[model samples]
Target: MTANRTALVVRGGWEGHRPVEATDRFLPFLRENGFQVRVAETTEVYADADALATTDLIVQCVSMGEIVPEELEGLRAAVEAGTGLAGWHGGIVDSFRASSDYLQLVGGVFAAHPAVPADEAPAPGEEYFREHVIEITEAGRRHPITADLDDFTLRTEQYWVLTDLLNDVLATTTHPAEPGRPWRRPHESPAVWTREWGAGRVFVATPGHDPDVLDHPSVRTIIERGMLWAARGSG
Candidate 1:
């Protein structure tokens, strides 16, 4: 159904998030779905007008990095012109921390994660990643990207994001009251959301911090569906 469509994957910045590994996890799936994929390791490609002009979707895996003015403008233009943008975790939502325009387009920004214990840090074998349950909102069950998916639990960073009210929130996770975790206001946060920007569609899932997290069946399915939903030519 995705035949003849083009997908550009841009991965870089903050190796701690394992951007390359995370982005690679979905490459084969995109290809199998009939997308001609192009990958770039830097944001410089975003400045290339020709490249953005022909791209159908952009799956960005860049974490904290500064995008040059020209490049940022180009990216905004591409998506404004009907190209789809989709990503998970720091790659999409947490990227370009200083770019307000980018955050507005994506509709959310990572604020913080549960703080680690200062005194009793878990050793090598002990589980350090926090486990949280994500529940699908009533609206999520009616949305194409999340419909038919059940709520699930994941052990990963539960992102605290500042979101725009315009976003169509699909799923959410709550901040559990635990040691060193004093969440100020509402505990529930958007786990997945979709928004419209100009003629483009934007999809975001905040559950992926590790490649293994993306391997989860529900995570994989939602992201795949989001990508397809974002693609212009894909049915």
Candidate 2:
């Protein structure tokens, strides 16, 4: 018999690339690979007890907002008991900054958008959403989720995150400021990582800045395997 796996997908915040678009792309991918998927456009997952209890995985696509405490607790309970939690870009890690507990749960926060500078507003030319090559860090190559993948190009927001010494560094990319660019510095940053929280697992990739970018082979493979591994946990 095929094992039944369920995932609750929550999508919202920052309508730029459209969270729904990203969820739409992944929901079918999960279903095709043997998962029953449920989609929510709001933070309702943070409330419904029955919905939270039955899920085997939680996929968040939210950017930033306030989450209800009960819902947060419910998710915490479900995951701690072995449910998987996975997401990309701002939807998972950078979504809820107001809640310290939420930040603690997700493992990191948005430090800066290299494409979008601090002082200047994002105009047409100022944005860095072009196709760029991403070299997998040595650690990433060893991780099951990223192993076997080659260096690939993606047209997405390369996220620079501020972490608190807990994540298992899996992959990274370096950003050096150009002479004509907005800033003046070079920082080698972690692009992906995994961490364990109780009986559950968490995997994050900072490169899913756009929906189309998810179509790349290297990108899709990491996300799919990461989600599956995070859901299964030490299995």
State the C-alpha lDDT per candidate. Answer: 0.89, 0.77
Per-residue alpha-carbon lDDT of candidate 2 for residues 139-230, written as tens digits (9 for 90 to 100): 77887888888878766677778776788887777677756676578776777788888888888887777766677777788888888888
> For each candidate, what TM-score against the reference?
0.92, 0.87
The 10-residue segment of model 1 with minimum total lDDT is 120-129
- Residue 140 lDDT (model 1): 97
Quick one: best TM-score, which candidate? 1
Please give the clash total of every predicted structure, in order. 0, 2
The true-versus-predicted C-alpha distance at residue 204 of model 2, in Å, is 0.8
Model 1 per-residue lDDT tens digits across residues 87-149: 999999889989999998999999988654656575553334667888999999999889999
lDDT for model 1, on a 0 to 1 scale?
0.89
Top candidate by lDDT: 1
